[model samples]
Target: MLDAGLLVPTAATGLYQRSGDFEDAVRAVEAWAGSLRLDAYPRRSLPPILPRADFLQTDYLRSFPDLAGIVSVFTGGDAEHRALLEDLDAGGNGSTVLEPAETVLSSAVCHSVYPTLDPAIPDEGLRLEASGFAFRHEPSLDPVRMQSFRMLEHVCVGTPAQAEAHRDVWLPRMAEGLGSLGLDVRIEAANDPFFGRVGRMLAANQQQASLKHELVVDIHDEKPTAIGSTNYHEDHFSVLFDLTTPDGNLAHSGCAAFGLERIALALLSRHGLEPGHWPTEVRRELG
Candidate 1:
């Protein structure tokens, strides 16, 4: 049974305060990432705001408009502010003075890499590891479904075969790592939450191609939840960003992304609330 305030609720519905044990588990996961042979250089805290135009180019609006956290601010000048303040005193025009910002809150860390890449990549391709906060407008009280969350992301850009192979290598490796830590883990093909009727068709096609695979673990319920994912976006971002291989073919891109908060929650669920009493192997590896 879940305690009343284990995840201390904040003003936001989907964001919650994490306990100290949860923080330690997140640190352990980061250490595990360092053990991988991905040759990924670490970058921390990607820019919070993304260019609205850049986001639009990625077709995010078409797929996840409902989940986007668009940045809007008060554009009112001094006079407008006073009027708005007066209206606020009157309780009417609080929203009227706000205008959309040039940037939207970032949803994923992977999109940040595309803008920094060269027009063409070398035969060897590129790999990067980054951790950052991302925002989605999901309004759930479940600790696993945070509106603001962190992702430890590993991205690869190369030929189609190379990209897919990268995902294949990491998928099982991650599962094994998590399993050793005492979590029930498995890999399965998956699809994103797309929008509308056309999006349902796109999701089916995506599953048919087996482009996305998730490392799922039993978190809070009978049905398992995905703690990490390996995604292969075959030339989709490449074409959009003009990324190409040495041979001039559009580069294929893939990523392995770990949800830090979700993993921490899983650890607490598996190992009991107290970290000191956890299994010896689990404590040793994390220590």
Candidate 2:
């Protein structure tokens, strides 16, 4: 059960250690991130959670209200809560409803990716690894829904066609990679976290347009939880943040995300954590 907190407390000594499924996921994602950043990767984070002005430009906050709720805590609040809320409230005087958000933290970390873009990466293609802690506010204490969580994403920004192609290239590789570990994986059209009213249209168009795909696992009672996702934001972030291609055309972006906790939970729930008894093949891959 969710014991009323942000990040779930674990009895395991080294949470980052590859001692269990959750830990293994964390470790692997860290490895991937480290390797990617080493090759001159360019990335950025929202100075504050995110300004209401910026989100409005991209319609990102309106689309993903849950994440926005987490961003709102930054606008104003008590010191302790402010520690987590990151000053991203967009609700001050405009349509920014993110002020004093429901939760003092982000419900998920991946949303932070669209908020910033580093223009230095040559536009032939840009590869990036973004990882961070995210919070979601709700009654989801299941080993699956810890209020605060971690996420790792690999992003590629270029042209619309290239963005889709990038997703295509990684989708199968990821499926096979997870499958090697005995995960039952499937791809499907996924929905964005669009807030209310007008934002729904943007989300619907994005979905109908098949701009995103999620790699899900059957974690919660046979209903696959989205562990990995690929999104093609054709000029959404570029136009919003003014990201451009080497050729000076508006760049299109696609991202692949791995929900650290959810993936870890899936690993633990399906396979035992003990390195000795665990499948030798998968264990070797982790090492």
Candidate 3:
């Protein structure tokens, strides 16, 4: 991509500035996905960072601390600033002078949405769709394993059956959607990269129960990339956020999330770098 002027690299390993063509491709993918559901789900816009308190409530720190990106800033006074500069000049790390901010970089696009949901959901449930930037601390040379990237998610909150149904419905739909773009796609059970030994157990249980499914496509010769996923969080967010269904039972939540950059990369990988030369049907679908 860098050779083709689609992605511009920086000093950071997993961070890069995308070219206009790259951005356009991402937008087209998002637009195509949005068109699949039309206006049935209300759209939401969210910031890249969320409150630390709310983040903590999600138990992400315990589950995926290695992938969490915390926002840090210099909150020091003038004297401290001078010392910090002097220290940096003396070959000290500037991060020493920074403190954790009130907010943390959001790891998932839907984390902020849960806090804003009504305490009691209606019988029909609540559905929302959002596209925003998400961050993860993992730094890698693989373009698909981006440290920061755009994510498009459709979130549902309601009873367990509704949540499961939401995930079930989107799993194949997303697979077919990506397949329509002329990429080989498949749906398979998957697990989150949980942390530690306990997390291993949790991951195993999660996979065993088929709680998460990914739409994967081959972007690299070595391994396939998960361009999208459907996860059914059974009463997880609802318990933390104090959400309940109309019958007073803890609500369940699920989300269908797509990595816009990954999809764009997949398109470039499969259809060549030139968008104009892509298949006519794919071009029309993107439009």
Prediction 2 global C-alpha lDDT: 0.62
The Cα local distance difference test for each model comes to 0.81, 0.62, 0.90
> Which candidate do you rate higher for lDDT, 1 or 2?
1
Clashes of each: 0, 7, 0
Q: Where is model 2 more than 4 Å wrong at Cα?
A: 1-25, 32-58, 70-116, 120-123, 197-200, 273-276
Q: Rank the candidates by TM-score, best first.
A: 3, 1, 2
Model 2 lDDT at residue 8: 40
> Per-residue CA lDDT of candidate 1, range 142-193, in tens?
7788898878878889999889988888898888877887889889899998
Q: Estimated TM-score per prediction?
A: 0.92, 0.71, 0.96
1-287, model 2: which lDDT tens digit per residue? Answer: 12222234566322222234345556674564334332467544322244445445655455665544433433535663554444345333332323554333444344455555575447467777767766554434355655555777777877777788878877776776667766798888977767778778877898899888888889744867887877877777777677777777888888877777676667655775443466777666655
What candidate 1 gets wrong by more than 4 Å, as runs, is 1-6, 40-44, 90-93
- In terms of lDDT, model 3 sits at 0.90
Residue pairs clashing in model 1 are: none
Residue-wise C-alpha lDDT for candidate 3, range 154-250, written one tens digit per residue: 8999999989888888888898888999989888899999999999999999999999999988785447889999999998999999989989899
> Where's the lowest-lDDT run of ten residues in candidate 2?
12-21
